[model samples]
Target: MLQQETRDMDGHYEFVTVSDEATIAFRRYGTPGKPRLLLIHSLALDGSIWTDVISGLQGQAEILCIDCRGHGWSSRAPLSYAIERYADDAAEVLDKVGWDQVVVAGCSMGGCIAQAFAVRYPKRVSAMILIDTTAWYGEKAPQEWRARAQKARAEGLASMAAFQATRWFGDRFRAENPRKIQEMMEIFVRNDLDAYEATCIMLGDADLRSALSGFHFPVSVIVGEEDYATPIESARQLAKAIPGASLTILPGARHLTPIECSDVIAEAIAKMIEAAAH
Candidate 1:
């Protein structure tokens, strides 16, 4: 049986497990009868990042916040990392829970997984909420930045944390939320280098642009007002490409908009779910 634990963060806890030998740690909130919403964490940080969002959505929706493989309590995979593997793992977890369909809300890396999941298992998804993520690089990234992925895999987490944090947050957010930013940075900075590198490689190589064109579901793109990584322009392009997709911009936020602007995200999600239900 899967072990359950508790924490005081709006009545959540650290629940970790190695399902089929894969490290799977996540938190569950709200009544089971509500529509299930799977919350996928960003790269580096664990599932705990969704605490604020989950707390607000509790009772309104059933929340399953997950830590992807090679992050949080989930153990590493034997082979190389790819976005598809994360999607497969997510599908398996949902299978275990007996959910036929769910609303997948993802951030950054998790957003990538959400795209792949909808492509691979269309029937399993009711809708998708992609926050600060893109299907693929709009233009080719710098060679050195691309090559750094391998270095991170070889050198480990300590060296790559700073670069990761810089890309994920803006200067304003760094100044305003120093302590919270530091805590999140540690999650990435202190991660196991190999796992982090593998995930980075996965993000670098995976392309979901083509996949989004043919996807037949409701997709809501949430962009941070000042997100440098996946800026408002990128989010607009994604929304435009996906037929009937909606877009929202969260003010005073960066790449971590779901966490930084949980109230707004929750409102967007609630509206999307309601629209779909009607």
Candidate 2:
């Protein structure tokens, strides 16, 4: 719970009003002059999802962990919620923070936003990592996503926690990380219903397959081998669509690679940084 403008460890938390008049919350870590990395979280989750991942990244890179407009400390009731809008928000945050270009990393819903960001503001992204996300949710996406949103609308976000847990982590991880699972559930249950519904619908209607092929920046697709929400097949499709994109599959991990495979992710970003320097 970082308050806006509360400086600590040479980093601070801040907020920026986006196109829709919604305040998006973000926290900066590490020295200002260091290389930057933008971390976006998944559906029903916030930037805190990157807590473990950030520790490995902090010393080497200046990291901006964002709580997307609809989740975490950001404004829950927004004028609209869409992947493109989220992407635009990222650009605004970058401008405010003076990060000209960065390595963008996102998981699940955040990955969609990252893809949208690269498309709309390509020059701002030097490299990107898409984890546990898809370009499109198949032909039945609209109906399927609508159903999920409707369930949350009717039963509430907490009701989906069990289902989300299974999709987010393999049985092994769930057994191994009881505390982490509980922490994530706490975040999921705090979400505003209206905003969560809108986000689900936005994901339902999102289609970025055509836009992905045009991406010229370095891209990497990482996914848990057991991820069901956005499975390995989806990751494979993303790798195939983006020119020269690399794909990494982690065994026994699920959708939340930021938590379950943070070290691997940090290594991948380090590689991205090394590659981008050349």
Candidate 3:
């Protein structure tokens, strides 16, 4: 039997075995009968990153926040942590919860997995919101990611926290929200080294550019004006590729738009859910 624990009054933490060696941890929020929303977080970050977004969405929808394989309390099995694999794990979560369709929202690495999920399981995704992510990382990204992975394995995640923070938040936001920045940095530092390394490789290899044209669902691409990791240009390209996709760029935000601009993202997701329902 999978180990299950209820966290707080509004959220339930549960683990579902997705593979022989892997068990994925996820949190359930809001009422079950309401519209379902699956929230996926960025690389190295867990589902807790969506706390504010979940709060903003209270009483509006049933939210399932997944800690993707190799992150958070999810098991770090000896499996390839590819983006497609992450998508499959997410589908397993839906299957476990008996949800037929959901509004899938993901940020950064999670966005890549969301793209894979939409492409592979078109019938299961009602809508998709890609946040602070791109369809591809260019030709040189794989090499750079591999190197980073090697370094993380050697030096540990704590060494990368400060550097990653720079890409995750803009200078002004970091200065204004020092506590929040430190909280996120702590999350990064707590990551398992092997899982972090594997995820870096996953991000490096994932390229969904050619696959975007096939996504027929209502799509919304949101980016931060100051996102250095996945820039606004990448978001524009993704919006152009997906049919009828709308693009929104939040000013003064960085790679962590979902955290830095939770209200805006929550509102956008609410609109997407509303449009998908009709």
Candidate 4:
């Protein structure tokens, strides 16, 4: 449903069709056998959301940045959107790419997808890093998420660009990188309204807290000190849910740390790569 790639990055785009008939889009980067990574982007955004961070992790990590169904070049599935379906799509993509296992990392909606992947395809994931996301949005999440979806349906995704900008980055990052902000805004407006609403309702009902204790792989939780979207409490809860998981909170950063705290994120991935090798 999205147009051809518009980001400034040079990732080689590829496409694959899952069992459900939705065509998914992904980009390959780095070399093989050097810490395989799978990066998932936030809601209303595509895999290119990791453009800046992917550049930082290049050469050292073989990575796949996937545009989840209905988000980017991926098809807007005729069925309703669900986190588990997205996870299954990731696994199918892995089969096509020949990746046996990968360090799954996701931000916001992607982070929720990462959690679902860990639960549904335990053998397919080597490690996981959850960023700026939560296992659940809380007691009133269903109502709140539905309301947000209706607002978008009525007013269009463009109406929330300013809000998304504020939640995604801090004043400093916004002032320093206006073009990236503009691109993000564009992506938000380009989303399919129906798919966007379904995805929101899916997220509203998504609950992975019960499965966190079952996670066998190494889990790392990262959050920005100023991230009110998921917030510090959410990251703390996630960290506590998984045994042996480490939590890192970046100072002065907001929800999208992949852009503002890319160096720190790269360091975290390096550490995970080392841990997996041992």
Candidate 5:
């Protein structure tokens, strides 16, 4: 069973200077003795999105949730964004904490980074958990998404927030969770347009499908039941492609299921970890 937090929980937050100039902000939750689980956020969102999931897993695992470079509290870098770069940043965070092995989990863009990490540094990852993402870039993404990236590069983040909102959430979620929708929009708006545009280009260019099949570690794939962005069909294909991988569907969930349905997501991940222990 998933552990429930009956009382308010607080965690310690700090910054690690990864590349001399760039400082990555991370929040540490749970005790020092527990196994560490790294949580990566989706594009336009920060580590805070994992709050709900963390609440359930805190009793079982220590979580190190990072705000990727160019998003949230992390310092922007002059370098162009890539999944590899994000993986390197994650490695840096783990190095700082002295965790040689960990369960790496990511959502959407974060999931892409996790795959990159597992492929590049297999020795560092004990297991991998991916949510609502693909190992390869979309075969034919909406042309308007590319257009929006270009617009953001030229105009600014404010002009791109609406498109982000539409792409990140399903219609029903946007209708029912107006407050959450508005909050996410604000985060996207807060992002530096150049960085966001660069990240979008990186996402479009990433293709790790070939490398995914080679990973020997335990892998679990998850998706929202109603995820239209990546879709459950695509996630199922990913599950089939990777060896010994299992897939779970979060019911009544949208693309933002990690945030909207954190309790279930956290429990699913916790259960996966427990099962892996044997």
Candidate 6:
């Protein structure tokens, strides 16, 4: 049996074993029997990234926050860690929880997994919110990602902390919210190297540009104006490719828009949920 635990203060935490070698940790929040929303976090981070957004969305929807394999409290196993694999894992979680359909939202690498999920299981997703992510990495992405994987395997996650801080947050946010930035850095540093490397491989190899047209559901794309990792151009391409998709750009924000601009992201998701009701 899966080990399941719940707390009123911290929501519900459970570990579901997906395979002999892999177990995933996830949390559930909000009222049951409400509209469901699935929130996926970016690479090297966990479901906790959605803390602020969750607070803003309280009582409006039943939210599921998953700690992807090898991140957060989820198990780490030696596996391909392909984007498709991540999507499958997410589906497995839904199956375990008996959720048939949901409004899906993902940030950065999480966005890639969301695309893969929507492509593989179109009927399961009623709508999608893509945040600070791209459907396809450029041709050189594989090599760059491979190098990153190698570096992480050798140097561990600490070596990348400074680079990630600069890449994920704008200068102003870092300057203004030093404590929050430090908290995020701690999350990044805690990632297991093997899992981190596998995720990097997945990002390098996965391309969903051609798959975007298959989505007939409503889609929303959000990006930070100063996001260098997956810039506004990437979000624009997503909006253009996904028919009838809407785009929102947060001024002066960076890659981690969900954290930096939580209120906006929460408001956007609320609007999306409201629109889906009709």
Candidate 2, residue 206: the lDDT equals: 95
Could you give candidate 1's per-residue lDDT for residues 131-220 as a string of tens digits? 998887554643433677667667776776677667777677677778877788778766776776677667777778887777678889
Residues 1-278 of candidate 6 have per-residue lDDT tens digits of: 95443224267678787744578889998777678999999999999889899988877888899999889988885765878878988999999999999999999999999999999999999889999999988899999999998988888889889999999998988899999989999999988888888788889988999999888888999999999999899899999999899999999999999999999999999888886777
Candidates sorted on lDDT, descending: 6, 4, 3, 2, 5, 1
Candidate 1 clashes between residue pairs 3 or more apart in a chain or in different chains? 7-12, 7-13, 23-74, 23-75, 24-74, 157-193
Model 5 lDDT, full chain set: 0.81
- Which stretches of model 2 miss by more than 4 angstroms? 1-12
Q: Where is the poorest 10-residue window by lDDT in model 1? A: 4-13
List model 2 lDDT by residue over 216-257, tens digit each. 888999999888899899999999999999999999888899
Candidate 3 lDDT score at position 88: 91
* Model 6 CA deviation exceeding 4 Å by range: 1-9, 19-21
Model 3, residue 67: C-alpha shift (Å): 0.5
User: Looking at candidate 2, what is the lDDT of residue 7?
Assistant: 25
- What local lDDT score does residue 157 receive in model 4, on the 0 to 100 scale? 82
Model 5 lDDT per residue over 1-278, tens place? 96644323466668988764588898888766666789999987799888879887867887889999888999874764767878989999999988888888899989989999888898887788899998776665434457768887788888767776776777777888899888888887888766777787777778888887887878899998878777899899889989999999887676777887778888877876675565
Error of 2 at 73 (Å): 0.5
Give the whole-model CA lDDT for all candidates, comma-separated.
0.77, 0.87, 0.89, 0.89, 0.81, 0.89
Clashing pairs in 5: none
Give candidate 5 misplaced runs (Cα > 4 Å).
Answer: 1-8, 140-145, 170-176
Clashes of each: 6, 0, 0, 0, 0, 0
TM-score, model 4 to reference: 0.95
lDDT of 1: 0.77
Question: In candidate 4, which residue ranges exceed 4 Å CA deviation?
Answer: 1-9
